[model samples]
Target: MSVVPGLVSITFRQLGVGEILALLRRTGLEAVEWGGDVHVPVGDVAAAKRTAAATADHGVRVAAYGSYYRAGDHAPADFDAVLRTAVALGAPRIRIWAGAAGSADLTTQQRAGVVGDVRRITELAAGEGVEIAVEHHPGTLTDTLDSALALYAEVGHPGLRPYWQPRLGLGPAEAVHEAGALLPGLVTVHVFSWTADGVRLALADGAPLWQPVLGTVAGASAEAGAERYALLEFVQDDDPEALVRDAVTLRSWLGGG
Candidate 1:
């Protein structure tokens, strides 16, 4: 199966749903992950449904619900609403943060809390036929590859998956290895290029790194016949022009040209 070149709508925070869909269509992208923090707020069923419909109207699929539902930090009631919103948006999966603290900084109690929540949430999502994914991010349990793997082992839920991203501080080789290690459980990828000091660069600047990451992901997806999306995340200066240009770069990276 071919890996889909997609966009995470939050990357274009300034644009409304209509504008975001239009921009995505023009980029020749096939899917979008709508952000709950902005484009579709949790519990806003009407907005979620409308955005989902608009995406389909533009010939784009709702890849996943990019929710800010931080596991172990929020209440069950909040998670319930998050699931409902995902159902409304017709998202196959819901992306969440691992926890409030980094793996190194987490207390034993915190780790247990996160594991329990992840396990519970996985079950909750399963009931709705929706998958749950933890974003590989800093200040969360998935800050490091080892920590992410360990968290998965602790949860051990088939419904749980990781949304892998190129760790900002790592070199190209290390980033590729880190993403590869999560292959068995990877459900989606967030693509971006940034410096150790948090400086955002054009997506093409990381081509040497992203190319292999994409290849690894594509290889795995091909074997399983499961769809995977390499969605553009943050762009330089949040400029729509930069996003358009990056989408072009991403298309080429996905072997479009």
Candidate 2:
């Protein structure tokens, strides 16, 4: 019923599974969302299982499978592979992109295509007891809060959830608003700090923005009687030490320190 502090494995994509797990043990992060693009590729059941075992050995849980299954871009059969990988990895949820195109760039039919695919994948994942989380990112239908809410409404399936992050250049007030708006269906948050121009900064440097946003997310999670994660991603300079420092800052914000 509280927000958990965790990491997105792709933050250290260059590291092997063993190395990443070892790093997790040092950071005190409670969970990891393994990236399908690298650490746990789709259909790689052997790798998924091995990583899951290693994650458990390191005393961390699999938060979700960070899959690159862009809905509407691929055939429906493709999601089956993603779902299988997530199940093998013991991930309760699979994170997917809404679509490859930006929201405004998509026509009505294209938007419908994405929505239809999302609905299909949601049902497929639910059949396996896994949920689907749409990544709230640019160059996708979820680029804006209203667009994201609308997409969810169209799907209208309990199996579909959302992952939120502070959009580039968004101020604290706007970020807080977006987080609050997504709270009802938010599954996890990709935590990071970036300048308006996309320069990664230390997590502590973004405290003014993150503090209230995290507070809002925590409140919503408690109210919904559900646990969610604030997962760290893309630290300054892609440095493991930066991740460790970010973890400390995140834990303090979550009252875990």
Candidate 3:
């Protein structure tokens, strides 16, 4: 693997198709990941097709399709559909989640089920040169890094990877620390901007965190075998330019373009 500058794969959930394509070009970012529930539902093939086409036309690379797949929910067919669309669109990564959080009964079966489905998807995606990366998201299944990693460990599938997030309601230090530790399983890192105690003008303005974040990324890069993409998934009501700035500063801090 080359020393990639941590490409920013923005989520298309908050932004529309056209706007997203335009933003990727304007920002000069190549990789993109999808969050089906956040934008176009994964089950909707028509919309997924349109989305896949648009990304291709604009010269944006589809890093992954973030799908809402519950470990307990045996829906490999559903994932197959999404993967088909993604493969057509040229995505090389697929993001799946752990079982839904707060469920009354959390069993090993739930974990095993997701592992099996993910392994199957990984095999299918590998044929298309895609990777199935598990994400650590908040307010959902496997919100924390530890729990998500446990499933990943138990599953013991080389294909099941991780997409790390710093702000799953954890402190900056904790978030950054966990993110650094999970580098081997990491595919990308979500970027966020912040003010001292309030909102900044935009996502670009979230430079405060970059100084420390770069350290985490650098250390992780050394630990991990390759330089994986440090993806920026900034969703703020503020200016999108700030979002780009947030991304740029992060790359710059990490010695990127």
Candidate 4:
């Protein structure tokens, strides 16, 4: 399968800071994301600044900040603070997770409250010149396409988009097909490996992993003429060398170095 040109930024939430960076080096991947749980905590100003410097020092792009801040659980001030830190990191997009970590018994009104909080934060994001990407991770606010779309409709701002993750359990084809509705509002894409628990399958032995995604994004960019980033979200596997090699595979498919 042919890959779209240009390397996609990626993040490994489970990997330690140095391990993640080392994986990036080994994979030849030039862009990386900060999973707030890992390298940089959301709203941590000093850490974010240091991360920004690391991006330059390593010659890799600081793609976005992945903050697993569920909707209503976070205070408005904290949400704003996190976005501000994202800006300081020179990242244009901040990735948000939409589920409650605890309290499995959330009431309907409670869910609604989460949505409301997200709307307000998104408004702030637009005002601050940053974009918010709601990751399509289920169980939170955006567990499904309908829910995610509803959030977008409620916010009604141009700065909010989706971080699509095509997965086996989510029906990869359906995720890919349903992406049409999200194409116009997409901040970035989260590529998947054919594995369980959001792990990164090895490049060579991996299922025909990246072809379909590359074809789809290439088609979308051609139609919209919008410059978008495909984030290679390697959820696990902390080998920098392998990570960089994976980037090479993607770039070769993308028709670039």
Which candidate gets the maximum TM-score versus the true structure? 2
Predictions in order: lDDT:
0.89, 0.92, 0.62, 0.66
Tens-place lDDT per residue, model 1, 1-257, is: 36898999898888899999889888888899999989999999999999888889999999999899888999867899999999999999999998888998978998999889999999999999999999998899999888999999998888998898876578879877888898877878898899878899999888788988899888988888887889998899999999889989999888875
**Residue-wise lDDT of candidate 2 within 118-212, one digit each (tens)?**
99999999999999999999999999989999999999999999899988889999999898888688888899999999999999999989999
TM-score for each candidate, following the candidate numbering: 0.97, 0.98, 0.76, 0.81
The candidate scoring highest on lDDT is: 2
Residue pairs in collision within model 2: none
- The deviation in Å at residue 47 for candidate 1 is 0.9
User: Where does model 1 exceed 4 Å of error?
Assistant: none
**C-alpha positional error of residue 179 in candidate 2 after TM-score superposition, expressed in Å:** 0.7
Error of 1 at 212 (Å): 0.9
Better of 1 and 2 by lDDT: 2
Ranking by TM-score: 2, 1, 4, 3
lDDT of 4: 0.66
lDDT of 3 by residue, 1-257 (tens): 22233233334455666776787677666666766664456556677778788877887666677766655464557667777666655567777766565322456655566556656777777777777777676544456666766666766767777877655335667766776667666767666654545453354554545556556666667666666666665445545675566556655666657
All-Cα superposition RMSD per candidate: 1.1, 0.9, 4.0, 3.8
Candidate number that wins on TM-score, 1 or 2: 2
**Candidate 2 vs 4: which has more TM-score:** 2
